[model samples]
Target: MVQPANKRLVTEAAIETRLTTERLVTEAAIETRLTTDAASRWGAAWASGSTSRLREFFAANTGPRVAITGAPIVGTVTVASQADASALVGKEVQGGVYINTPDLELRDFRIKGDGRYALIDFGPFASRTYIHHIEFDGQQSKDTNAGLGVSSGTGPSDLRVEWNNFHDLNDAAHTRPGSSYKYNFVHDPLVWNTAAWGAYNPAIHPHTDGFQWLRGSGEVVSRNFIEVPYKSVSATPNTNSCLIIKTDVAAIDNVTITENYLNGGTRTVMVNDGGFGLPTNISFDKNRFGPDFNDGIWQYSNASSMVFGSNTWAQTKQVVPTTNGSLGYRSAQPALDPDPLGFGCVMTNLGYGAAATWGAANDARYVRALSGGLINGIEFHVTVSSGNVSVGVYRGRGRGLTHMPYDLVATSGTVACPAAGAARIAIPETWVEPGDYLAMSCDNVTMQLLLFSGTAAPLFRPLGAATAASHPLPASAPSPASPGFRMPILVGTFV
Candidate 1:
């Protein structure tokens, strides 16, 4: 009877063990299904390639991946050693991240800062640092010193910055030579009052830029969407340019800027000589410029060996002229006019009576062409203003002559005089050659022109009676009785 009871107990124990094993298996299956569904959702979100969705995923994810919190990185974090750099991967950093390591690869991260730079690399010149798959958010910090999204130290480190989003910063990046920037979206730069931020002279302050290359060479900036809106949210031309290639620190050479979608800013692109001399081998090609700029498409000063080709306006699809250049005495006289005496020159049709001797024809001043090009418009500094005036350009009859005759070429319709300051008048395109004199005439107004007094062997304006019409100025201007006393300030936009 004892043996039979022991067998019954063993059988019941075996049945209980089987039931526990089945329950454990069912729970494991349910956990696997939940994990698979979560992974599928994550895959779909990533495949969408939407920035907002990706940001959302990063915000919600935990464990190995750091999420973007939209808050400033706590303090200055230094990734000085190789181990530190390796640990920085897949992390979200607040405040500034200073990198001083070599061959460091920083990926899958977000950096928010209120400092001079979100990420600054002080690595060796040939460190070959790679930064990608990152978001740099400036958070629109009102800190006056807040600066670029990414920047390098004094050395021109070899950096590859790609596949990143940069916004709300003073500038997207300020790179030196041997840097390549591609597949980046840079927009909505931070705007600040120049006066409030007393760093730069208030006049030229808030010099925001998309990609600024202060110096160095062998840099390639391609396939980037850089937009510096013409007006800030406060509706001001606070943004400066999309790209600025300047040799502020040292000379730059062999820089290529191509296939960029650049829009807005006061001027979309600015290539300055930087007083260090012209940047060599600067290439800008196949870039689309948006029409949202406040000033012009691009302005380059003294660039040598520059290749500007296939650049077009996005809306009109018109090719941006490579030869679009400015001509005038302003380039020569960068400072204010030293002589304050105004040349009280009256327009031809203005009732000057006896004073008509100093009228349009007599007051005409010629700008000698340094090189051959077409004049599209005229800009002049106005001292005293009067009524509406018609501006006209005339072609010189003789080369290398002081008091040569001129033939009317093109003239603008009636242009109203501004209260005071400079004015621009657009005229029909007219051609001119080297050594040719481009003279200007105005009708039906009285204004004081900027004067260059005591100019030797002056190019005198020919004295003539007031022609009935200011435009189509007399077929041949009369010869001058005396050498001109003053040189009037007038410049033309040429191409």
Candidate 2:
């Protein structure tokens, strides 16, 4: 009795209902799978006690968040000497404090500072220092550099900073070696007023950061909430990063950053070697990144023994991809002050003199590989290019006396000299193990290559002398015990 159109409509409705049911079932399956995965991961983590404190410290609904009200001020106290700092056990006090002594404990304090730092410790070395349960409010002092600043004096300071609130400052903390920063909240950095500063010059205005590790080793940064909002009040870019691991002053090793809620900045985390050496054992694991950031999440350069795992987004819980970048002479050097030319030069064992004359016909420089990977090509800077050059890879001898190239492996055929600048010689993809040596040879002495001097030079001895042709390097290159004055900027690009 129904028309054909009515029957078609009913059939379509039934199909649509069935499709909706299937979609719901699929979604439910996905939800169950995700829940199971999360439970398994969390259960293992909890059982081991590795992530139990991290879960309880930064959980939005259950964690005890840091706030200014938590530090109830008892009275105002000025800590200038070791005696004064040692006396601040459980008192909730105010004002800037200087800490240069060992075995001191500071807790439950509210520091409102207008100076450069709330707690400053420029130590020869301060061991067993604990700072916790404090609030550093820089709202009253808008021009503060950091809430806490600890410099690596002669060695590790061995300071532990935890459970603190830091806000309204340029940077929350600037730490060095032998430090552990955990369970702290650092957010809402001071918005730069461009009108007052005329322009946003980084030298004068200073790009803000949450934590800046200038240099050193054996440091752990975990379970913290660090955020520097993008365009919070102003339009200009004033913040640098939430965390910056830099080796400008010295080499860094054994630094672990894990299980933190990090957000904002130009880049949220930046690890730079500064052409000093490859920072080793640098790990970034199980951290969560927030949505608000001007640039990407993270970047690194010249870092060896690096581990990046289980980093996820806070909103979606999806894994974040690796964003790797390099700086210094390892790639192309930026046009900053104290350029590569200003670093001066050193004579290579290949018979190049201090004046850059090719004294020896066949001279070579060897650099140890900090990581194991397939090298695609060799990048080097030619200060005075006249003749062709060749690159070679060789097996290292043993661990201790492996300064020079031991056994021949692979070599890039002689390539014509390029003009004075950065040049790349593409070689066959060669597999290099960690601690292997990369060697370079020049045909003529006039072919001057750039070298690094001062603190930026490599710590290991890398120069070797050999009398051999450009195509096939010598079987063995003998190196001296002393590191000498210069390090050749011969970098191997990896696949």
Candidate 3:
């Protein structure tokens, strides 16, 4: 934590007398009230205010452009020079705000700067950064996903984009950053990339994706409300998806997705060309998806390492079987971040997973069930060699070694998606005991789990299986180990 100190900057006049320029530091801006988006620095919410005098507000601004620095730049914020977005290679940017400035005093509106947007080529972005509560209503997607993007000049690392909303993107060439969390609502969902035709207007432009991350993108998505975009008269630019994450193991890894609601589209969620498959080390948890869609959290390619967690669904195509709790994506989450736990296995309940690929003898042998409930969708992470891996479930009464139940839950074998074929495995339902642990890891990397207690219905446990050769479990929420995610399966739903 960056603590505020007694030592302070002695006014700009005092500093100007000594230094050449007031290169406002990321830390100092918060103390001096000069930087409006300072809250973002400390993992806090970014802020911006509105004003009545829209022009005056935008005219009297500094940095990047005239109307977007210091405080929340409303009215009209843009770049002083219309150059390529890549030009912002090394320029450091503070947080973005969604409020009115002293001048603009505008209400409930955030406008993007004109011309090409900038990219904070924060090399590899070792540090965690965020863009929240702001709106890029008038911006044009210069890259894959939206107006502003973070692409390093050389190294490619991980970055976080959250809580922000984008709508009415002007242009939609393939240039947009295809890999991002499009949980935000795009009022004018699609404005196709027909820029080549030279006959484009917002009114006639077809609607498309809300938030989509194509190949070469790896980031977590949660707490977003996504809707399907409108169809264009001449073209169908957008499909319905809160997220369109192209699956390519080489491009993305360790992406955590949770707590989002997507609905109303030709395809409600997970629209993939199967260029590769889902990125590796990705987890989907606690999201609510509704009707008017074809598939529920699906991918075709053999991208490895993906987990789907507790999510709710109201589908029109297949009614997502009750047993899908452990099969398809979602079907739900910890509301608050559980306080840290010590280092040990805090096994309380047990969730049932199945592997039919092991052959029909074991395929239809076990039941697809969770002893706890749906909300108790437990998670356990382990490392497995790129082959058929079986997870040994060792449940115990508390943490005592002797108390470890002898095979309380059936051992689960992953349907390991090899280059040739993939397999299906039932997700564990009730395996955790709902308590914090010191630390948990299966193979080597730290793993998390959620064995929820079904809230809406009885612990929806399905007991059927086929060759676990190509099908994998649904989107498991992130932090499989954290507390607060409880399905609280009601006994009444059983009848």
Number of the predicted model whose TM-score against the real structure is largest: 1
**Model 2 bad stretches (over 4 Å):** 1-94, 140-156, 194-203, 303-305, 325-495
User: Which tens-of-lDDT digit does each residue in 357-474 have in candidate 3?
Assistant: 2221111111122222222222333222233333322222212221112112222344442232222233333222222111111221112122233222233222211122211211
- What is the TM-score of candidate 2? 0.48
TM agreement with the true structure for every prediction: 0.50, 0.48, 0.36
What tens-digit string does per-residue lDDT give for candidate 2 at 1-495?
Answer: 999999999999999999999997996697457535644554454344322123333332111223334353343354445457645544444545555567776665566654445444444545667766666666533353444433343443777887677776777787767899976778657766555555655555546789887777889998777867454224466677899888778788888898787876777788887666767888999887754465467677753547887987553356776756422111121122211232221112232323244434555556665544445577777778887777767655443443445544456756777788888777644445445567676677677666543323334454332334433354334444234333456666653
- lDDT values, one for every candidate: 0.58, 0.59, 0.32
Off by over 4 Å in 3: 1-109, 113-129, 139-158, 170-187, 191-207, 214-218, 229-237, 247-250, 271-278, 292-297, 302-305, 314-495
Candidate 2 — number of clashing residue pairs?
Answer: 2
Q: Candidate 1 regions off by >4 Å? A: 1-73, 123-126, 142-145, 193-205, 232-235, 303-305, 323-495
Model 1 per-residue lDDT at 418 = 53
Q: Relative to the unseen true structure, what is the C-alpha lDDT of residue 84 in candidate 2, on a scale of 0 to 100? A: 72
Q: Write the per-residue lDDT of candidate 1 for residues 123-201, one digit (tens) a residue.
A: 4543677776678887765554566788757664778887677877878888866889976778667765445554434
Q: Which ten residues in a row have the lowest lDDT in candidate 3?
A: 486-495
lDDT of 1 at 444: 37
